[model samples]
Target chain A: MDILDLAFMQRALLAALLVGVTAPAIGTYLVQRRQALMGDGLGHVALTGVGLGFLLNESPVWMATAVCIAGAVVMELIRWYGRTRGDIALAMLFYGGMAGGVMLMNLSDSGSSANLSSYLFGSIATVSEEDLVAICILAAFVILTTVGLRRQLFAICQDEEFARVTGLPVRMLNLLVAVTAAVTVTVAMRVVGLLLVSALMVIPVAASQQIARSFKATFALAVGIGVTVTVSGTATSYYADVPSGATIVLFAIGLFVVLTALATPLAKRRAGRTAAAEECTLEAPGERTAADDVRV
Target chain B: MEQPVIALRGGVASLGGRPVLRGVDLAVRPGEVVALLGANGSGKSTAVRSIVGQVPLTGGELELFGTPQRRFRDWARVGYVPQRTTAAGGVPATVREVVSSGRLARTRFGMMRRADKEAVIRALELVGMADRLGDPVDALSGGQHQRVLIARALAGEPELLIMDEPMAGVDLASQEVLAEALRAQVARGATVLLVLHELGPLEPLIDRAVVLRDGCVVHDGPPPEAVGQHALPGHDHVHPHAGPAAEPIRTGLLT
Candidate 1:
């Protein structure tokens, strides 16, 4: 089938394109901050959110989104519970959330009501018009916030305590990050399953960082890779009868490997050239002061 | 004598129900470089953080610029630089942007305006990193990163600059560069309060020394007079400034 032939395929493409652009954009900072695991952990927390949605007879997507945001707040509260063991707090949260979700799922007798498999593993073929709309709106929100606070967000991710010392309101910025991660997981859950959304968020950016020369370049490359994985994975699943989630993950990993291989040689060549140039320039530091001031 | 730019009166700070700073009274005036000397857990950093509003005082009053203020929001006039550069230096930001963060307190809801931008540039220039404004902070050497952090702290154009162990683990070159910059800040009429373990290397850089032992001010005088003494042995003297001292010590001396 042509990539956009079916109406559902068109919706799927739109959703993926939207999710692709925003997830990696946010993920770039997450990766830089070394909080890449936050995405995965938050994604798992979304499972209980889905379960809560199923239980309430509300639109499961809306309910799930709400629950996911609540989980984000819960994650923030865990900070007060313990220090230096955020992972332990995260694990406790993850287990408790999952258990609550299971109980909710069983209580509602909705084990099979909402096509739990589709939410857990994801299916592009099942993209509904409503899902497409939700993805677009949430994606827009994510993009706007990320761009508006890009500078501060980047600063906080790089060094929170330092940012605080500079009077950047570090704790508030951290809460914003956690909230954004939750929102990204909620929107992305439609394209890739909740369990797999973080892979999409982190993999492309991880690959991009291996090759890109600067942070901005890495961010751009990650977005490109995200779009590529989503589009290709959708098409491959349509024609090859493979699992969409697995196909998306495999495509991301494949791209990561290829990019790493390509980047290694290029990075080496650039390193050698720059080293020679640096030696020449430093030898006459006085002469190159004009350009050195602005060179990245 | 001039009034203290930062004044903490009868202040007490505690972590986990134990006091770190007990009835600690201190004052820092403009152009004075006060070294907060302490053994590993002496609340030297805690007092500095309290001055800047990073840590809440469990009791007592904190005043910035001679006003009777109770909270950190009131002390934005006082700038702070913590010990660790690696914390903020990891951001892929340029040296300029990192310095620009100093204007956060003055910004409207922390937004950077045109004047804010200029101040950031000026601050970086002050720290001698204006030449490397576009370079990623992480690309710099540790000392360079430390300078950038100082530049950031200076961006606020603060009357008081509080630093917690700015020289810890720093190379000799960085130490000298930072010491010079710190002196320059004081020369510009900014009060400087720094927390340190030993006063040997930093003896000449400071005007006065305020030493804490067991969460109380055990010594408060000129660094020249305080140099020969070490508050205690086996103390890292580099612990967080806000929390109670992590050291087990004789607590009744200052009480």
Candidate 2:
């Protein structure tokens, strides 16, 4: 209750909640497309935007959004033309953006590694009044896209070719996915930090899929787990004095482990139930194959 | 002469700098079941995919339902079942979910109404996969996966159905079920174009067979007589009294 009194703490918790919801919401589609690490690429590129913001004396969040959207579109284009070598290209983009960010930060007016570290590792101080407003706006966009077009997104992600013939505006929808993913990356940058944001995007969905039978269930369960870990991680960081971003990411990984362990027993139980009710039997034809049924 | 449902003229396609479809011609009239047959690397799949706009045509004229492909926007009239690749994606999805996506053609803005849900179930029932609706797609056997894919195509109830290797890797029992389902689709005035390596049970249903060899149409007419291996497209009949190079390039044309 006392920690809630602090303005920065309030902003930080609110931002964490938004990150928890939006990360896995958009992440479900990315995972379905098997582009689970796309958020990682966007997050790395956003570092360049943050650095540019510092050099230009502007808001890093907005700049990161613009830059990430551009990077995501470029990545999508590379995917179209360079299918075999897209990974190598993405690797170049990632490292180049990261190195450029470091170089640009050194040239900025506040040329200090400490200033950049706050954004890289996620400090509570980064969620200023203005940053919170920007996060809210960006998160709103992410939520709307992910939820509003869930079926369309699911169709495209599940089977791009099938969706194309279904007349799904497949090309435009693909670009939209890239754009939405970029928005989500920047939305999470303040709370989860650029380095650790992908974990929140990927791990929660991974954990949920272990038990979820359908894409819809996987999505709902992943968002549930995301909200659980992020909120608790923020509270732990507040009382125990730790980095909020790392704490939240570690919390998600821990949940994934627990769910993975639980998946085995749950799977065994379901398998047993289905096995007991099995209708089709391996009865070889014309040889009284069922004779062994009673004998065995 | 009725306007063909699918009209491809001098269709040319390439993969990795190699011309897979070099000046190929194919057409399917309304309510006709046409099977494109060929051996591996014969460009049969490429030709079918090109008509569906899945493959890039290097040079060709493609018309779907009397409209040029570039301007054709009536996709609800077309259903495509792509050649299944073992590309189980990053997350699990139920069989029903996958089939429901096929009904996206009939929906507005991807919203599934009551009629759409019924259509999905009806499609599954047509393929005898209604029972597995709740099961995860990855948990199914290969033959069952094929049935689900066919069901997905059937869900849209398209005027023209394009399938690639719907029977590949499928069990004989599943094949019979698929054959029966295709029969029903034809009975209802649906046109079909499929790519198959062997005619098998589908031989009786095919109104015509267009065989491709080295990216060219080598045969086009009534379904070939499936007299053992003789009916197989690109089946090489080794002659007893011949030189060491006894296996000649014998497509369905020579048969």
Candidate 3:
């Protein structure tokens, strides 16, 4: 509670809270679509934007958002039109973005490798008011898109063909998902760092699914776990003098391990119930009780 | 004269530049139960998929309910069940949730209204899946999972229902249940189109059978006289077409 007195600590906590809510919100859809690593890819693409920001003496956060959105749209296009070995194309895009970022950062007047290192590892003390403002706006977009259109997203992720038959703008909805996921990546960049951003997005969802039996439960529980880890991780970093990004991601991984262990007993109990239900289904069709002979 | 509920004229589709449907023509009248049959890779699935707009036609034209496929926007009038796929592979979802997605066609912003909820439950009951509404789809057996998928399609309550490989991987009991459900839908005058490997329990309900070989319509007439498995003309490696063409009798590519 005493850490609340520090101005920088307050900013980091707010950023952490937003990151917690937005990451898994969009991440649930990505995981459902079996593209859990898309966030990591976007993070790499965003580095180019961050470097461009330094080169132009503009806000790196906004630059990263623009670059990430562009990369995500391109990725979606690749998924649509690329005929062979699409993953190799994605690998090229990711590495190209990373290399381009390093080159651009070196070309900038004020930017150095040390400055880029902060973006890679997430320095809480460096989160400016402008970055916080950008995070809040980006987080809002991620939350609204992920929650307001959950059913549409769920239908698309569950079965894309059926979704198209239902007259959903499947292509448009897919593009929206990519864009929203891009925004979420940038929102977490200031808190978790681009390198570790995907962990926060995927780990909490992974942890929640261990116990959650339904999409609704998985979504709510994952978001709950995300908030818990991010807030605590931020607080711990303040006291223990560790890197906030690593602390947060490690905390989430630990939670995943704990929840996985807890799910074992729950799964056994569920299996027992399922076995009892199957007993009824396994009854011989012609084997009848006295009711068969009795006239109604 | 009644307009056909579905019409595809000389439909041509190529998946990955390899032609799947080559000059295929198909039509389904109102309240008709049509079965599309073919051997492995016979383009039966592709033909049905093209009707539902999942597979785009590279040549020719498609129309749904008398409107061209390009302009058909009334999707609530149609229900579609794709080939068997795990309903919840990466993310856990319950039976009710999966069924409710079918009802979303009637929704405006994905909000589940009370009527929508009732329709989902009713669809589940149609497939005898109401008992497993709260259970996760991952817990269901293969046959039961197929029933859930059927229930999902039925939830839309469409006038036209399209199903691909609904009987694949299903047990005998579940097959009977599906046949009975299709019977009820036919009784209510709903149109149906399905892709089947064999007639099986559904033989009695099929009003017409359209057989395809190498993406061309080989047979379109009354239910074949064969009642037992492998008694159908297309079941063997080499079968006679009775002089439709003066060329040699074609053999199944797979055989």
Candidate 4:
């Protein structure tokens, strides 16, 4: 089989592109909201949703999507009920969901025969045309919602009470964010598997934040980083004969560390330059016009 | 003279199974900047949270713009600013994008109109933040962040703005700017209520003070009378100066 055959590489490339775009689009918000952990949680939730489908002899993707949506809604409801302590609620739901799944899998005799380990760690070789189509659809949905609600999500993530006070339907926006996460988790389940999808959600953003000057740049850079990691990890796995998901995560971690190191020196120099400029200039700090900040 | 924009009677609020606010009764009319004063854990934040529906009323009746709390449509007229600015520190959004969020209650899901842009721009200008409208919030100073938050609240065109510790971490210069902007907000016929630990800087900026202790309203009146009520013992009313003549503190905006 020619490694460069147009169709074979095209399918993999399409999968990588869809995963690259959707994960970071949703991951940017998740990382900012301190719910990066939710990505890990929902990944597990999708696993259970997938497991349930396997036990019942149903289409795993359909079952997983349905379960992921249900899990997202439950997470939202739990958060609403426990408003003041959001982290506690998230932990409870994530752990409880996983426990329920483990028990269900243990009790079902059929679950043992399904080779569910691959689902936990993921197996990209199983990427079917149907799964690819689903990823494409999910990618569109994530992009559209993110772009459409960009301002609202930005404000709410920064300060929900502030956003709520301004009458932004904080709860509905929260649900939208969670649903976006669920969709991303479902799409990612095929590539990174349940346990590791969160790395895809968090590492790229962390790396981008180290170097990007503004929110727009950070998100764009994060998405770019995501795609780069996926492509490099895929290439490395083929060459080295290692697990692709683990390779991808290791590559992302390397990117984050290198970026952080480079960013520190650059940020220090910029600060020094700005501080010197401030002494010579009379313009009040924070008085720069919106245009100036935007340009940065 | 007009109906109170917010009214709570015997309202109670609990957090993490602990009662933070108990039997609290308070009300505010439009254009009034009411200061909430209390020692730590006196339920000041809880009382404010109840008004915005962030904290549910465990008991008693709560109303907004004369409608029952449950019937109060979000963003219809109420606005809130929590103590923590809560902006995502790393997202790549500009100040304009954040201010435009104030219209979330109004815009639904779609492109913003010229009117929305105008409102956002006006909000930025009001807070002395118009120049930084394009700046990313993460790069801002603490004072600038606070002003951006105020800009966010103003973008909603809210009839009532509820701010929690709005001045806590703000620098003196930014405080003056925020105070001037708040005065303008009151002048524009909006109701303002805020929680503050110290009344020195904010004394002159507000119309009245609602003092809270142990989750209940100890006094609600002009700054003078409220100060008097604090001295009538059975409650701990220790001011920074116990001296008999610490000139009647003007509440709201330090300078």
Separate DockQ for every predicted complex: 0.18, 0.37, 0.37, 0.31
Error of 2 at A128 (Å): 0.8
**Order by lDDT, highest first:** 3, 2, 4, 1
> Mind giving the per-residue lDDT tens digits that candidate 3 earns over A71-103?
999999999988487989999999999999989
Q: Highest TM-score: give the candidate number.
A: 2
Q: Write the per-residue lDDT of candidate 4 for residues A1-296, one digit (tens) a residue.
A: 36457454556566766777778878888877778778888977876777687678776676778888888998989877767787787777777767766666666666763446656765665677877888788878888877777777876786676666665678898999999889888777777777888898899999998878566677889899999987777666666877667777888899999999999899999889879875765787878764342222
Lowest summed lDDT across 10 adjacent residues in model 4 chain A is found at A287-296
Clashing pairs in 2: none
lDDT of 1 by residue, B1-255 (tens): 777777888889986677889999888777788888877677887787766666778899878777775544544566778765332221245566667666777777657889999988878877678888877655676557777777878888887788887765455555666777776777787778888766645678778888788888877887634232225453334446435543322111001
Which 10-residue window in model 2 chain B sums to the lowest lDDT?
B246-255
Give the worst 10-residue stretch by lDDT in candidate 4 chain B.
B246-255
Per-residue lDDT of B112-198 in model 3, one digit per residue for the tens? 989999999989888888999988887777778888888988998999999998986666678888999999999999999999877
* Candidate 2 per-residue lDDT over residues B1-255, each given as its tens digit: 999999999999999899999999899999999999887899999998888888889998999999999889999999888885324357888888999999988998889999999999999999899999998887887777888888888999999999998877665677888999999999999999999867877889999999999999999999766676565675544323334533422111111
| B-chain TM-scores per prediction | 0.78, 0.88, 0.88, 0.84
- What TM-score, to 2 decimals, does candidate 3 have? 0.91
Q: Write the per-residue lDDT of candidate 1 for residues A166-196, one digit (tens) a residue.
A: 5566788878888888888878887788788
User: What clash count does candidate 1 reach?
Assistant: 5
Docking class of 4: acceptable
Give per-model TM-scores: 0.83, 0.92, 0.91, 0.81
TM-score of chain A of each: 0.88, 0.93, 0.93, 0.86
Error of 3 at B190 (Å): 0.6
Give the clash count for model 2: 0
